[model samples]
Target: MNTVQEAKRYLDNAREILREKAHKEEGYYLDTKYVKMAGHTAYVGVLVALDGLLGKKGKGRKGVDWYNQQLSGLDKRPLRSFVGAYDTLHLSMSYDGNPLASVAAAGLAEAETIIKWVESRTVEA
Candidate 1:
């Protein structure tokens, strides 16, 4: 499959994990482990979509700095979305394991935005 498909699968898997395993109670998830897993999974999906559009820098390994730099040069709008994804998906959910349902919702929405933006660009190219 293409990068868009692959990236979307990652996101789908993340949603499934949250829906099936995270054990949501009202507006929060009870399982921090599952939350972390889903966050990491979704964040990776964002990276995959971005990489598909940006290509690899081939500077040993990639990091947030590299991604932000490339995206900032390309377009500031998507750059903001990506930064939000990193903060919400990567840091808040993945590391801190924030249990707020709204946090996850916002993060997931941001991931979707980045992936769709990448898809639009790739399809146009």
Candidate 2:
């Protein structure tokens, strides 16, 4: 598959894992692994999908800038905020010991929004 399709598949699989975790008792806390995995998957998948769609680079600082520029139209700034929030949360989880509670919340919200955004785009395409 192409990068966009691969990324979309990852995000879709992540969403399914997240939903299963969300159904459990203690949910988010009990299924921290799924949450963490989903967060990372969504972050990378969304960035790759965005880069593919916008015809830009697919990683690093330039990739982030490309995403921000492509999503400069939302009223509440959901797209840009989602990307930034997920990136920050990913960094914290991957490097800074534990992921902060607030960052987790932000990442979860961002993940959900990004899935929604991708769905809409898929429908449009």
Task: Give candidate 1's total backbone clashes.
Answer: 0
Please give, for residues 1-125, the per-residue lDDT of candidate 2 as tens digits. Answer: 66557766866775676566634443233456666776677677666655555564565566555556667754346566655655654665334423344555566566556656665666687
Q: Which ranges of candidate 1 are over 4 A from the true structure?
A: none
User: Model 1 lDDT vs. the true structure?
Assistant: 0.95
Cα RMSD for candidate 1?
0.7
Best by TM-score: 1
lDDT of 1 by residue, 35-69 (tens): 99999999999999998998978768899999999
| lDDT on C-alpha atoms for all candidate structures | 0.95, 0.59
Clashes in model 1: which pairs? Answer: none
Q: How good is model 1 by TM-score? A: 0.98
Clashing pairs in 2: none
**Residue 107, candidate 1: alpha-carbon lDDT:** 95
Task: Report per-prediction Cα RMSD to one decimal.
Answer: 0.7, 4.9
> What is residue 76's positional error in candidate 1, in angstroms?
0.9
